[model samples]
Target: MCHMTACSLLSYIAIAWMKMVPMQTIRSRVQFFKISALSLVFCVSVVFGNISLRFLPVSFNQAVGATTPFFTAVFAYLMTLEREAWLTCLTLVPVVAGVIIASGGEPSFNLFGFIMCISATAARALKTVLQGILLSSEGEKLNSMNLLLYMAPMAVVFLRPATLIMEENVVGITLALARDDIKIIWYLLFNSALAYFVNLTNFLVTKHTSALTLQVLGNAKGAVAVVVSILIFRNPVSVTGMLGYTLTVFGVILYSEAKKRSK
Candidate 1:
């Protein structure tokens, strides 16, 4: 929670430093409400994502994360009334099935963690869809930096109450941790930087491409994470688990190709 708050704070400061969006314009009632809704969805995704990682191995988390494209496609169509090609929809079959197969073989899988991961994935998809819907218009559209400027402060506001309710003595504990190990502070600073950049790039990419395209790229990220995590963490991954992960990657590739040809 502290790390996420730092990330949100960093986002606001960086955007404010850049002067990407006028602070005054952010007060428009309708725009503020829409962006706030988007921020809430995004915060839910981030929170659940963190919770899932605490219980699930990174490899398993990424494997399940590979299902993002499936959810993205579903939400995109529902929200936009934009039907995809039949082949593209069909491709999601294996993408979803692969996760189920991987779940069965995941040694470290916790049911609660699995639920949280799925919720996170779904919320992420919803966020992407909502971003496109609410902010894609000529009148409302803001560039990536400006979008982050508006959304990040709202994320910080939304996260504050949750952090207080959940953390018990978060400030004291964090201060103690920082006091005990200066390295922890640096680690958090590093992660907060990564989070801010990750979000900015996600918005930039989504602005340039469709929501599904971002998730397709994320599919490759999941595959890479699986490989790197296995190498670094030496996770006890089963053959079935690897196969499921492989299947999910293949499905993402197929889905991407189908969408391209449809275009």
Candidate 2:
């Protein structure tokens, strides 16, 4: 949360110096409220997502996280009343199937971790759906960067109290971690920079495409991450799991083609 807020502040400074900040104004209280609410959801999702990782293997987490696209499609339809192509809907079948299959092969499962991961995944999808509605509504659209500039501060406001209540010796812990390894500071700075890019690109994509597309892309990203994990850890993969991952990639390709045809 601190990293996100820092990036937002840095973005604000960069835009201000560029003299482009004025163009990224919030037009109304309603819009401000909407952004704040979305940011709160984002905060919850991130908190739970990190917590879940402690109990679940990365592979299982990714498998569960792959359900975001399914939830996004459902929320987009229900919340935004956005109709998607039937083919696009059909394409998600294999995506979910593959993930479920892959998850079934997981060596361990914690009910708590599964629940938290699923909650995080659902909250993430809800965030995307809400963002799509908020950004696509009437009047001038908020600049992608500006939205982050505003939302990030609001997220920090919501996160601060929660952090104090839930975490122990936050400042001392951070200082201790940094003192133990100065490289940790550099890693954090690097992560913050990448996170800023992720937020900026996410907003841009959500503004241009439907939320479901972003969710689908997120699943593909998960698949890629899984492959990277296997390579990094030198873990042996089962044939069933490999086929499941392969099917997910194939489904993503099919979904992309269906989306183009729908357009």
Question: Residue 231 in model 2: shift from native, Å?
Answer: 3.5
TM-score of each: 0.88, 0.90
lDDT by candidate, in order shown:
0.83, 0.82
Residue-wise lDDT of candidate 1 within 85-172, one digit each (tens)?
7898899889889898999988887999999999999999989887876557666666676677667777888888878886789889
Candidate 2 per-residue lDDT over residues 1-263, each given as its tens digit: 66677767778886887765664778888888899889999998998998898887776677778778888989888987888889989998987888777666665667788789989998999999988877777783676777788888888888888788889798898889999998888887888888888888898899998788888888778888887877776655677777777777778888889999999
Error of 2 at 244 (Å): 3.4
Which candidate number would show the highest TM-score if scored against the true structure? 2
Residue 195, candidate 2: Cα error in Å is 1.3
The runs of at least 3 residues in candidate 2 whose Cα sits more than 4 Å from the true structure, single-residue gaps closed, are 233-240
Among residues 3 or more apart in sequence or in different chains, the pairs in candidate 1 whose N, CA or C atoms overlap within 3 Å are none
Residue 6 C-alpha lDDT in model 2: 77
Tell me the lDDT of model 2 at 55. 83
- Counted clashes in each candidate structure: 0, 0
